[model samples]
Structures are given as structure tokens and as C-alpha cells.
Target: MKRTFLLFTMLTTPSVSLADNAVNVVSWGGAYSQAQDDAFNTAFEAQTGISVNMVDADDPAVPLQAQILAGNVTTDVASLGYSDATRLCDENMLMLIDPATLRPAPDGTAAVDDFLPGGLSDCFVATDVYSTIIAYDESKFPENPPDSLADFFDTEGYPGRRGVLKEPRFTLEMALMADGVPAAQVYEILSTPEGLDRAFAKLDTIKDDAIFWEAGAQPPQLLVDGEVVMTQAYNGRIFNAAVDDGKPLKVIWDGQIYEMDGWVIPKDAPNPDDALAYVTFSTDAQALADFAMQISYGPPRKSAASLVGNYKDTDIPMTPNLPTTAQNMANALAFDNDFWVDNLAQLNERFAAWLAS
Candidate 1:
């Protein structure tokens, strides 16, 4: 394929200047970062003779902005969610990235045209599309497994502690979904006061029994410890737990909230040229497909989809595991970055107050 051919050529040619010899990347750590390390960083270093340093953060956008505001920018590139990437770009906190710089598809599709909707932007070129899904410990629900989003809210039907993310973004939308809102209408309803109240009210059904988790890794741990029977978790995390670690967990794809996450350069990165080089190489179709094989996240490039095959070191097909899979996406909500960009602060404050109450 042209993509792999491009990767092979680039790997052999080593065009990036080695003067800086390093690029610092901040991302959500765990299996996700490991995938990037395996598919991008390691290969990037070998390709350019430049060292790749990985930094962990709960949200890369936070530290990314802090570094810029402090006028001591250390990070070269960051993996950020769609809303953060959009907002940071609008605020001029991130460097302008031209889509033309990205590698085209093997079939010669332009990068701008090949990237999935919301994947290519002024300062962001998405790598993957992942989702927040409910994962239940199979040992906990042997008789009658919880299969739907509404089941997550049915405390009496499946009574046990529920693990929820400690944020309004996915949690509120999920609450609304479990309350019977259509996937397509979630953001529309969420944009209204009545819809907001309805979502919180649904959440009230299990708020007292909810165990909140801030990090992606916590949900699986919560299930393993038997602290929560089911949890809202990043789908990739649950996949890693079950396949990589032999955890007795099963993902509930209904009402899953999927979103794009990708690379952004800080406005004043320590190695701007090198950062651009790394981003370009890493977000290419071949690199994205390789990353997807390492984890369940769906690659954003249309060309990458065909390149994706089985999970790394396993016979399990990766397509079925991806959030973009037809079956998984049937009832999924494409997380509304526009809504979050506008209402995140207000919803966060409200969520905090609700938690206290």
C-alpha cells in the first residue's frame, strides 16, 4: 500500500533534523500512551534518530495551557480532546497546523478530505476516535447481565455501586441517554435547561451509590476490587483489562459517547520543527492503523480503516472493538464538542454543586 510504502521510505530516509534530538509529548497515560509509544514514538525515534519523551497527564490540555501561560513551554506536542483542541486553537494557545502538511492516503486522498468529520482542524489532526462505555464485571452479573444504558441507571434491578467519571461531559450525556433521550438529540436536549434538569434527576437515581473516578484507569480497578459492579470507562481501558489482563469485564456499547482525540503543538514549543515532524509522521494513515491495532480506538483516517486488522499479538479482529464499528455505533453518540466547548465551565460548576449536595 502507498501508506506503508510512505512509512518505509520515511523510516529509511530520516528527513527530520536531529539538532534538537528529542520531542516531549504529553498525553493521557496507560494503554493509550503505550499504544502511541509502540506505534509512533518508538518508530519515530528509529526513523529520525531523535529521542521521544512521554509525559503523563489526566488531561494534556491543562498542562499544555499552563506551560504556554507560564512562558516556559517545555512540551513539544500534546494529545487533546476535540473540544480542548478547538478551544485552545481559538484562544491562540496552540500553534497553527496546516492540514496540507499531513501525509495523504495511499490512494492519494488529501489529508483534509480523508480525515473523518471533526478530525482535521486548524490546529488539530485527529489520530483516533474512542468512546466512553459502560463495562460490567461478568462475575458480578452472571444471572442477568446489564445490557443497556438504562440498565446502568436501574439501581434496584441491578443494585450495586455504579462507577461514574468525575466530570459533567460524559456523565450528563449518559444520564440523559439512560433517561430515554435519542443519541442524535442528546446535545440538543443538553443545551436546554429542562434537559439539564432531567439528566441530573436521572443521575439522582444512583448518585448516592455512585463511585466517581477521575482517571481512565480507575474504572477497571474499581471493578476488580469489587467496589463497583459496573462503570463508565474509556472503551480502550476495558479492552486492555479483559484482553491484556484477563479481567472478567464486558463492554456495554449502547449509548456510548464517542469523540476524537489527536495531536496539538503548544504555541511556543521547544522544538517546533521537530514537533511538526513527529506529528506529521505519527498521524499518517499507517501510523494511525498501527496504533489502532495496539488498542481498540478507531483510527480517524478513512484509509487507515482498511489498513486496520487484528489486535496486536492477538487474533481478535480490531474492527469489532472500535467505537466506529457499525454495531457499536448504532446507538452511540458522537460526543458534541461544540456543546462542551460552550458549556463546559457552567456544567462543571453545576456538577460540583450537585456532588456536594
Candidate 2:
């Protein structure tokens, strides 16, 4: 752990030469950021001699968007969710990343060919597959723990506040699923005005009982603090909390909402050329595989799966803990990126109004 932190310091320290040579990176902090520090920052700097300056954000897109609009884009590369990456690219706020420029798998498979379907976007390069799932601290429900999405909304059944993301993306989808909508039919049902309304109406059942969270890191902390018995959390966050922090948190994979988190160079990035250099090194098959060892997220490249091992400092193999693991994925929902890309604004407007009211 000391070694990793020191590596991050060496790689991210803003020396006098940093601005000229470093690529500024913004990411969701805590263990996730540490994962990238191990998987990306140190290796990229060592190989290319380009320093990296790291920054944390609740969501990198928020500050990165501000940077682009202020016409003072400072960060060279910021990690983002798929829908956010697509939306920013749609708004022409991010640089187009051609797959041809990225390094492929060591087995001679093209990078584009090796990456999972829908993994490549015109402007974003995918890093890893992460998920939002139900996680509860075991101390509360030691006898009979929460297992499914239904339990998340079943305040009367579970009898505790449920911490959920304040945003509508995973929240709405999970609500609909809890209301008995099948995973495969979630987005289809959520497409209609009535469908969306039904999802919110389901949430209304537990509105008073819901302890909403805004940041990716909050759900785990909420569980630790006894704020919520069960919360919707990024699978990787909960895994780290359980394994590393020994928090006794347990993730229930039923009705899990899974998606990829990718990298995007903001439009007018201060260091466009070097930023691309960083992305090329960081998103390669081996790099992503190395990244998965630090965090439970699954590598986007199919070939990269062969290279994945156990979690950092543990014998617990990383694959079965990953959202994409067959055992865990049995009832997973592939978070519809296109659906969110199209309906995000409208739904979020509705969600905000609902929350305020």
C-alpha cells in the first residue's frame, strides 16, 4: 500500500516540468482512483516519460464540462460513464478517439476487435465494466440479508433506510426492476412516459425511506456509518470496502445494473497530443487487465480476461467478484447506454423536480 501511494505521488506530483509534459487526469477517487493509479498512471509515465497529474471529482464530466465551456480546459483526460462520454461527445465537448490509434491485445487482435461489443464509441475509449448493485453491511441483517432489488424498495420488509444514488440512471432502472419488471424488459418499459412514471411511482413507495446519495463513494460510507441498511453502490467500491477495509459489506448481484466507464479527452484539452498518448497506453489490453487486479471491474477487452488475477493483496480471485462474472451476472441488467443518452435530460429534469417536491 505504501508502495502504491508513493508511486502515485511520484507520478502525479506537479513538478515545474509537469504542465509541459504531464497529462492531467480527473477520476472518481478512493479505491477506484487508486486502481487507475496502479493500472495506468505509473506504467504510462514509466513507459512514455509523460508525467500525470491526478484530480478527483464526484463525476469527472461535471468539472470537465465546466472546463470546456469556460474555454479554459485544463484536464487532458477525464474518466466518465458511457452516457456522459457520449453526451459530451455529442455536444462536441470531447475529442474524437480513433480506435486505430490504440494498442491492441498482445495476441495480435486489433484493439477494436478485442474490445467488447458497444465498448467503442467515436469519442470515448472504454476502460472497465462496473456495476451498481445492492450492497448491505452484514451486521444489520446477519440472520437474513437483503438479496434482490425488491428488497431495496421494500422498506417495510427490510425495515431500514436504503441509500441510493440521487441520479436517475441506476436509481430509476432499479426501481422499475424492484416493481417486478424483468431485467431484459427494463429499458423497453422505461421508454414510455407511463413506464417512467411507474418507475418513479414505485420509488414513491419508498421515498420517505430512501437515503439518497450523490457521489459514487457515499453508499459504502453510508453503510459503514449505519445510515442505510442496504444501498445501491458501485460493485467495485463495495468489494474494496468489504475486502480491504473489512467492513462486512456484502453485495447482492440480483438485478445488478452494469455498464462501462471510459476515458475521454475534453475538447480543446491543454495537452491533446499527450492526452491521446496516455489513453493509448492506459486502455490497451494489458493495461486494462492490470487495472482489474486493483479493482473488481471487468476489462473491456475480451482477451484481457486471460491476464486478470486476484485482487490487490488478497487471494480472492477478481473474476467472480466482477459484475461480468457469470455467477454474478445471472440476473444483471445491461444498463442501456443509448436509452440514458437519449432520455437523460428529460428524465433527470423529472427526477429533480420529484426530489425537490
Among the numbered candidates, top TM-score falls to: 1
TM-score of 1: 0.83
Local accuracy of candidate 1 as per-residue lDDT tens digits, 262-350: 99998878899999999999999999999999989999888898888899887899988898776888899887777887899999999
Residue 325, model 1: Cα distance from true site in angstroms = 2.0
lDDT for each residue of candidate 2 in 302-345, tens digit (9 for 90 to 100): 88887888887778888878876678878888878778768999
List lDDT for all candidates, in order.
0.86, 0.84
Off by over 4 Å in 2: 1-22, 55-59, 62-74, 153-159, 204-209, 215-217, 225-227, 267-271, 337-357
Where is model 1 more than 4 Å wrong at Cα? 1-22, 45-59, 70-74, 268-271
lDDT computed for candidate 2: 0.84
| Structural similarity to truth (TM-score) of each candidate | 0.83, 0.80
Candidate 1 residue pairs in backbone clash: none
lDDT against true structure, model 1: 0.86
RMSD of 2: 4.6
Tally clashing residue pairs in candidate 1.
Answer: 0
Local error of candidate 2 at 331, Å? 2.4
